[model samples]
Target chain A: MKLTIPGEELMGHGNLSCQGCGGSLAMRYALKALGRDTIAVIPACCWSIIDGPFPYSCLKIPVFHTAFETAASAASGVSAAMKIKGKKTTVLAWAGDGGTFDIGIQALSGAAERGDNIIYICYDNEAYMNTGIQRSSATPYGAWTTTTPAKKFKSAPKKNMVEIMVAHKIPYTATACIAYPEDFIKKIKKAKGFQGTKYIQVLAPCPTGWRYDPAKTIELSKMAVESGIYPLYEVENGIYKISRKAKNKTVKEYIKMQGRFSHLTGEVIDEMQKNVDKEWELLIRKEEFYGHTKE
Target chain B: MKKVVTGNYAASYGAKVSRAEVVAAYPITPQTQIVEKIASFVANNEMDAEYIKVESEHSAMAACVGASAAGCRAYTATSAQGLALMHEMLHWAANARLPVVMANVNRAMGPPWTVWTDQNDSLSQRDTGWLQFYCENSQEVFDTTIQAYKICEKIGLPGMLVLDAFILSHTSEPVEIYDQDRIDKFLPKYNPRYKLEPSETHAFGGLTTPEWYYELRYKIQSAMDEGLKEIESVGKDFGKMFGRKYGLIEKYRCDDIDTLLVMSGSTASTGKEVIDRLRDNGERIGLARMRVFRPFPKQEMRKLAEDVNKIIVIDRNISFGNEGIFFSELKSALYNENTDIPVYGFIAGLGGRDITMKDIEGMIKKADGKPKDIIWWGLK
Candidate 1:
């Protein structure tokens, strides 16, 4: 394999993240791309604990652990403060799915709408993994979290966060998977080049939350993209482009590999497959629509 | 430069002259004009600062925490419901020990929905480890704001300068806006020992176990204990630079008095006038206006209480299911004193009801050296 990723490690070892924690790798790759002159504003997420206790941190860059709902807002503050000081430091708001899709959505929306100069990355683990495996709005349909037991799985579909960011007409919005480090790093680097709000949601599979083998974290992340459940794509300046084409794997294969979806019946899996297909079709149509227009 | 401006504008000028590097605020009734004036100043290039129009007061304070932690002077302003919304971040800013100063127009909280003056909005945040300053008028609003930054930065805590809604916020008064060079000399740049710098990286507010969490809280209390002395010295420093003096509590004609009237914010102004008229009639009364409420001037209260036979605290804010909030805190402050002074509790002028000089006189007569649950004045 060609060594395309940066060799200089910004994230040190001995992090407190669980074994095979995809969120951990996501932070590592992001810091490598953003370099050392970056300030990360993290909310109440697994990364908050992953950075170790107070007076000690795992990353080389400064990390500001903030309240659960104010990651984007705090990042805006950091950006504003640095801007006034004439410091060219990259402000990154690194949050989990719960902080992004649920409690943090308002602050994220406000930051995006204002076109604040900050890079926001949401490491999507599908649930609130830090507190426990509780279901968040990012949890896909038929997913079983602690809050959504076997008898009552999550009925709602996962929120389409990229489209929401695209709606804000920000400079850039992308979806990358942890299995593809090159693509994730590329998106973060490209986001740093832009001078406004840039959002990227990276699919990070959690073995503890998903009830899968710890060693299968990378495998599950790859399967999620190949199965068309989480297509790697980016929206730049109102134009959508799929970064990686799906490998034509079935959604059932992706679901059966994870214990969180083991109890789902064939009928529910089929419905979820149909939902994924429809979303992919809509994304393709959006690309085609923009391609045909002057915008 | 003596500029006739509203209390809200005085706050804007205060932040401007203090050279705040970043300002984040959300508009609420009685506070909207403060940010508006700040926006005008920024737009007109009068002040060089980043004004973040955050979506809510929670984010306003959150941005202030971020900006302040990032080693910049951060400021913000809000009102009643907005201040209540910022309750969580208030604790965050204080715990992180960020010297972020804010202006809160004291508006009454609502169910019937009002935009009226009351101290309940700021008094509710008494336990949040923030230095609270209640301004008596527009000049005090301007003067205290500059002094708040100096005091808070010295103590490594956040400070809130409050002025009553409409009475101070909307009312225009002559405020002397000091020269920028002199104000800058009084309050130097905010140079924090620890900040969120990329060159010097460290995790702030991360998870701390019980072994360190208890001690971290004790440190905050210790800083507040130091804050009392800082507020006094900073007030004197500000007075020496400018002609206006300040302290935790302002004493008016309390040298020789049989009774002392205690109040805060605009009510203190009323109490001062009422005291002058009563003293003219040889009533032997004085007034103690609570300027800084957090490091509650207990020592000052005890020293003054020894000379007076009675203490009357008129609170515009209620603790609900108890007597006036100030009344309760005042009694607690006097509890350790060996004096048997009858501290009277007066709950009046709630929800923006006008408390006239006559009302103050009536409360003074009603004290009567008697124990009362709550003397509800102007309650029809």
Candidate 2:
């Protein structure tokens, strides 16, 4: 099959997204790779507002702005319908951390378990930006949102959604970041080739929610990967392959860039760093275990 | 082919003959056998459809929504918890106006988690805008499943074919499985007038501003209202071809009866038997079975309630704090009428308990002795 990366900007420029919003860029690049044969299912989040109002759509493809918890199931339906009509199109469910990890977990789990032929991408911005920056299950420890102020920061670690996806024994699962555009696009394109359920969790930095300089969006994403906070890896048929191995930058480099973690003291930063290191080590062991099993 | 078959198999056979292109399913008791049969049909190449084994009922409905939006006829089946899980997507399927057909094996919602027959599961979603049809027997289950697709596509609204859990879902009855050729002649390929195609760019699930939101809702309401007539016509056409006619409401021995027993789903069969037995013994008792519940069948219900001095509604589902869900709708439907009939609501067979002819006789006896406001029958 001839591969044609879309050159047309289906997601038009001059939208209302914040400067260098990683979520906005994720949609832009995803559309480029998937082409016009795509329907984006967006839930209640920044993208829902970013997609522009009715009669003036920002993207060229049809977008189904669904309820906060329905993106996964809605996308699953669209994908099944497409297969029935003999239309080879990708149904992409684009949701935020709050939508994916909290409200929409049941629907997401259902779609994954059924192996519905759909690509569900969660743009993890750490917190709910659309609903006034509330803490979500995906919010990392020590992060500050409207719900978790400096007086009471988030105590729990971010929910390991990748592990949950792995439990479903889906055909494809991967972690990517908007900072690595090539890797993110590659994972999405690779997911399209597989026939069953595929999932990708992309670390999208929110300048508004994270309280960061708008220009540091890409930089923060890169720091997240370098610090091993977000590893780029793919799980193909239960075989884990770490696509991008970090050079191991200090976690401080990633935390200092975001205001959500600005209130953390030296001890809290170190604790978060230790947690990140432990998680990264476990991910490495997983890659080794799954890789050896595949061989 | 005429054969003794479970209600689940009859519904599965109906979907197969209808040539449903997609079936997204999650297993819930009573409804599980229906999907299992459909899966076997797909596996055996008896049907050309994508069998999506979803993890939850919510996704099952979601997958159906996607398939329907892509311009393909989609099918799914669930009961109780599964139906509750798909509650959110049920509204979306209707609001999106996708002609997705689902079979809800009606089961009681639980604090007890019992897997038994009840109308609460489907009736709870009464306001979701999808058309609801209750089946009385295996034959109605088969015919209604086929007729649902036609009615749904005609009105561009999703339709649910509901049967009493355990009673119809597990019980075996004689059903004539219509041939594929006959089904093809009756239900042509489903061609959706509005679909999510890239060639024709249109907004779906877009932000409906104040200017058109109410109008869009009113249109859906009007579509549902129009569906009432469409369901009756389709039922007439189906009966003419298959030699079995079904109206929005099925009336029996109500011509001169002073008291009418109103019910829906499989228990209605038992009610009919009870009514026949009573009629033979010089009792002026009749039965009214509601086939269509969404458009409410207000006209037919009024006509049936007109001559009756007392109306007894047997509901298998409850609305918790309120009376029987169907009974509330019935009372509201007849509130303004000048009829002097005292309508009584009876909640029975909840949590899948068997509603035998004895239970019907007991309820009819109670209604005969000064009809109460709401009676909880068959309770321990």
Candidate 3:
């Protein structure tokens, strides 16, 4: 099937985001895939600020900047309204990790359970970047945020949001990253085709918050996938398909690229590797259970 | 079309006539039937709206906010715990200035977990910057719901039309449903002056520095202050179109009265009946039904309270450990005014108990003399 990526820039230039802000890039790519008919339900995140002040916005699409936790519900509403008007417009909820994993979980779960026709995309930069890089549930274990300093790095593992979304038996759920623009665009276009609730988790790396070289943002994301730290996969109708399977690389390669994880010692690094390996094992099991490898 | 409907049905019917684009709601007691009827309307294609069956009340409001922001009129109904669950998003819908209309069936919040009628749920969100209107009867419930959209859009604020749970939500009465064509003329299609449009570049709910934060908040306040006039104008227009005039405060037989009974919601109907009986008996007792609660009709309330030798406030909701919520606001409104009459606060019909005309008579009798800090009525 030929991919029909939007050629027009619905999200225009001159945004207020920092250079190489992953969240802004995520929105731009998402708009390119979803098109001008897409309505973005933005929660309280950096994108809310990046959208620019009132009477001045960067995006050319209709954006409803809702509360911190209301993106999912708001998207559901917009979808319903479109259905009412007999308009086949896509309602996309663009939120950050803090909005998705923490405050917005309830609304997200509700929308997912009801199978409300919406596309919920979470740009996972790992922390609440808008609130001064505070640790969120999406923050990886052993990562250091302002709230969880080097002395007291995050102890809890990052919540498995894609699995949770798949558990709702939604039409589509996928993981994408900025490093793989084609794959990211492909997944978004595929998501647009699905009928019911569709969710996309994009691993958007923030240079300022992650304390990495702004130019290396895409490189870090690529390393994150190659090192098996952030595997790219898609779940459709309970079937899991590993979209990108990279050669196994050292977790240290992914960690050392960002200062947030610089505090991890050998033991903590090993622990992180063990956790990633265990999660990968589970994904492989799911793939085996659902995808059924060709003979 | 006309029907003998309950206040809840009236609200639902009003929403139906308004051609609400989306109806997102979760079922809670008292308010369940309101959404049930709305759902049936959508399911039957009687109303062209998407009836979103959300998991919780919080999402219900969130969905309405989304629909409104998408440049479509949206509505939802909830009571008590459902309203409490929607507390945080209520502020969001208001601040985002989405002209979403919600009908809050006033019920007490839970601790022991009661679903009875009380004003605590809506009153608790007094500072949320949404326009709040209380209804006295099925007619008002139906009329106010239609009028709220106009007021909300005019002031760029969301509106909450509240009716007492059980007392108003379930009770049946006479309500005239207007023709859809007439309603269309009265409430033209919602054309939001400012909305999220891809063709136009504009931001919403963005970061505000200290320099602009206060100004934005003051703008909201100024809009609210101007809303009073807008509300009155809509009320008059609605009356002229629909033959039902509602105001910030609806006065009853207050002329040449020495004592007045101040109340809101269904209980005001009871107060009116009692006031009529007392007037017939040659007692100088009158009734003041407060229609608009938030943007608290302060000046009008004070002017109305000035001539009365004694003022009695009947509140169906309490603030717990303090006087009645409405009473406190009333007292604040009358504070420093030249009213010599001693103000009395009477808490009544808590936990959804029926407030009869006899209860109003008792409250009127008690108000003839100085009463305690807060007198609890219908406790037995």
Candidate 4:
């Protein structure tokens, strides 16, 4: 089935994003899904720079570049203000992986638990791309960040942010990839249908941080989902649904494409693959059990 | 309506009457009651505002920034640790030029963990470009909160109304609640030239190169300069509308005085009583209650010290390794005036130590020695 991409674009040209920036494409698709009547509450992320410098913005909508840990709370305030003003403007909280899973987690969790009316989109680029590839909680195991060098690669697994959101019993939570614009856009539109906090963690690979060819950003995003390293799924209320089934591709095939994982020995790669498999198996079990159960 | 209420409730009523469109805050000691009162106002359908109970004080200030940027009047209340937590966002709010007013219950900063009245909390945030107003009473707290919104909105800057923790925050006083219609007339709807609206899409707080960052900051400094006038004018307007007038500083028996006592917050109120007692004993001492700290009130300080032979500052907060915060700032303000007047710096009542009338009189008597450095009064 051919996915009908929206023809009209809300994202303007001449953004400050790096070439082949998957995060930029993710934002472009997000804007298309959100339409023109939206406000973006961006935290300290690549997009904060990608949106361009002061007095200049790449999006047709208003953007509030907030502090690193305040995207959710700021977006909640924007949503509250919009409600007071009787305007139906969608407040989209856009943050990076570091802003989401680490520094911003408290505010994000508070927003979710309070059922703040905003769409919190954590564009998961793994490491802190804007700040020279520092290690973040969302950086997967066996990855080489500046803080977690090749000598001592990231030993911790990526945080399960969507699961945390689901635990808050929010209206919606999902995982999408930049390679799949249709799936990502669909999830954003679905989130717009819900009133409370809707969280979407989209896999946006960073070429600079991942030490991969800039041209392979999309391909790496696709590989991330296909290899079950980042699955495409949505959890509405308590119902879990896998939007796109993983192709069961080997993690080594996905890891070999990125230089950040090149130093990973076969043993470590196998261990990483085993962790992903265990996580995927648990997700599948959750879908089977909770998918049929009412929230 | 003449009803007795705590400083926290007065702040809630002030925010309520000023028609704050949004209130986002966290509960901290001494400041919890302010947000609690706001929550009660919202619950009872008395205030038409969105009360966002944020997780932390950082988020509280951030939400206010967002709400204000979104073309709504935003307000919040916090104390020492909470205000310290919000230090980063306080700069964010001011630099963004969002007219978000906050009520800070002046509590002492802690290492040994004490929640009591002091000016250190608010004074530490003095350089954040927020227009700081130190109130002496519950009435002033209420009036300043309203006037803060006006002054901040007019000058495109944020403002913080400060009242001493427990002394003013928890203590009940008979505050006159003005008619809502009159308040609406005084502080009209917050209609900013720019806002976070889609129709007038603009990026706020974006990454700026050195090319624009300097000018943006210069504009903030210039706004603070103009904020001095706005505070005075807005205070006058508030006075005209509701019989009680305010200014950058409130003078008590300063006329024909050879020596002036300078202080802020609750200590200023105690100083006034001391001034009256000293005058009865034929002492030529008076009190200059500093109501506004930001914009420094430099011109006021200069003029107030032009005729006085000596200036004495009793600070409820210390700057550590330096003199009292107010004393240091006041001395700097009077530096260029060529007054050569000796300003005595006395640090007292830190961590909520009681500053009785006797303590004020004693500090005043010590000023006669003309100490050149900081005097840690009542230090054990």
Pairs of colliding residues, candidate 3: A60-B198
- Expressed as tens digits, the lDDT of each residue in A174-217 for candidate 1 is 99999999999999999998999999999999999999999999
Best by TM-score: 1
What DockQ score does model 4 reach against the true complex?
0.88
Give the least accurate 10-residue stretch of model 4 chain B, judged by summed lDDT: B364-373
The numbered model that scores best in lDDT is 1
Alpha-carbon RMSD, candidate 1: 1.0
Chain A: TM-score in each model: 0.98, 0.96, 0.96, 0.97
Q: Which 10 consecutive positions of candidate 2 chain B have the poorest summed lDDT? A: B199-208
| lDDT value for model 4 | 0.90
Interface RMSD of 4: 0.7
Given the true complex, what DockQ would model 2 score?
0.53
C-alpha lDDT (0 to 100) for residue B281 of candidate 3: 92
TM-score quality measure for candidate 1: 0.99
Task: Tell me how each candidate scores on DockQ against the true complex.
Answer: 0.87, 0.53, 0.61, 0.88
lDDT by residue for model 4 (A1-295), tens:
7656787898899899888888999999998899999999999999989888877998899999999999999998999999999999999999999999999999999898899999999898898999899999898888999999899888887778789889999989999999999889999999999999999999988888888899998888888899988989999878999988856688999999999999989999888888889999999999999966763
**Which lDDT tens digits does candidate 3 get at residues A1-295?**
7655567787777788877788888888888888877778888999988888765678887777788888899889888877767788888889999999998998899899988899999999999998899999999999999999999999998999988998999999999998888889999999999988899999999998999999898888888888778899999888888988764777888899888888789999998888888888888888898867432
The order by descending DockQ is: 4, 1, 3, 2
Cα lDDT for residue B45, model 1?
A: 96
What TM-score against the true fold does each predicted structure earn?
0.99, 0.92, 0.93, 0.98
* lDDT (10s digit) by residue, model 2, range A1-295: 6544456787886566877788899888888778887888887889877887666678888887777787888788788778767889788899998999999998898788777788999999889887788999999989999999998999998999989998999999999998887788888999999988888999998899999899888888888988888888999999988988864788898888888888999998888888889988999999998888878
- Over the stretch B1-380, how does candidate 4's per-residue lDDT look in tens digits? 99899988999899999999999999999888888888998999999999898899999999999999999999999999999999999999988889899999999998879989988989999889898999999999898888998899999999999999898888998999998888888889999999988898899988899988999999999999899888889888887889999999888998898998988887787788888888999988888988988888998889989878898888888887888888888888877784589888888899999999998888777877646668888877
Give lDDT tens digits, candidate 3, residues B5-70: 887888899899888888899999888888989988988989888889998898899899878877
